[model samples]
Target: MISISDDVKVVENFVRVAQIIANLESILTQAKNLSLTAKNARVVALRAGDAALGFKPITNFIDEFSEQTIASTTKIADLSNQLFKVAHKLVRCSQYFHQMTLLKTHINSKQADAMYQEALKSQRRAASQLSLALSELENHFEDIQKQMQSAEYIAVTSRVEATNAGDFSDSLQSVSDFIASAAKTIKTAVVYNLSEIHTLRGVLK
Candidate 1:
């Protein structure tokens, strides 16, 4: 009976840890949103030409912030993995107690029923927490997809704008501008998609 009680406590702790993981995931989502917004701002500023003299500072700030956000997300992901490992151990412990309850069912039928009920409740709670975490993770991926599409559009627009601005005396200058614009677009899109893919993989794991 004491062991059964301990198992239940372990399960409860696991659930609490899972909830904390979910909250951290939500924070990650917010960080992604901030990163996307910063990138978009930089794109707009770049398009505004010299009139946007403040663009450089804003862009630099965004670059630093985005990097920090990514680092924080990585840390959170590592912590979440650790939490999941704990949950897995707790589940195994619960199963052992469950088997023990079954072995002496005739003598302690009522006690066994109570213990089983508690175990089932823990499982249900854990499952619900996992489901919520998955949903949030999926939403984060969706946001990334949207950001990628937006970046692609911005890149294409930048190319068109540069083309319309007229030919340069130096062919190399025209080529340089085109290449820079294209690279910016590609870089933003890649970052968004790669991060999203990584997050999805984490959720699946």
Candidate 2:
């Protein structure tokens, strides 16, 4: 039977994953905001004519990256939930050992051995399946990290391009600033959450 601490660790692991899901939800909100801001930036860029023509590509990249991040964040959340459910099942399967162990004294020696072997086999099977699920979750977490980095890069670059277009159009500059702010917000959101995500991954390992 697993120790109480081990049981708590499973719950802790699940909570850690849930925390990641919650952070990603926050990122998804920021990404959506950035997307809308990018749309506004596009309008401002068009009005600036050639003076802000360089800002056009920035808007496109920001919009696309936001959409990708939104999608990635949502997918990772779903995968985390699935992993938690599966892990819960493994935990439940394992708890059978504790119950069998309680009844050990009542059973004959041969029967107790047989029960132990059977529970051991079942627990091992559950563990193997849990390992496979965890590997998939780790891969999904890696993908999320890459997507966040890409989103951050696009935000920083867009801000630079907007600043460089400076004085070309005051309105365009304002929208550019908004886009940069949105990007900064996205990065800021990831900064605190990514640490938690990495921690969750470490626990899984």
Top candidate, metric lDDT? 2
Q: Candidate 2 on 36-149: residue-level lDDT in tens?
A: 877988887877677777789878877887788777777767776776776676666667765666667567687887887777677777667767765665565566556556
The window of 10 residues in a row where model 2 has the poorest summed lDDT is: 196-205
Error of 1 at 90 (Å): 7.3
Model 2, residue 149: distance off in Å is: 2.9
Which residue segments of model 1 deviate by more than 4 Å? Answer: 1-108, 164-205
Q: Residue 65, candidate 1: how far off, in angstroms?
A: 13
Give the true-structure RMSD of model 2: 3.7
Q: Which pairs in model 1 have colliding backbones?
A: none
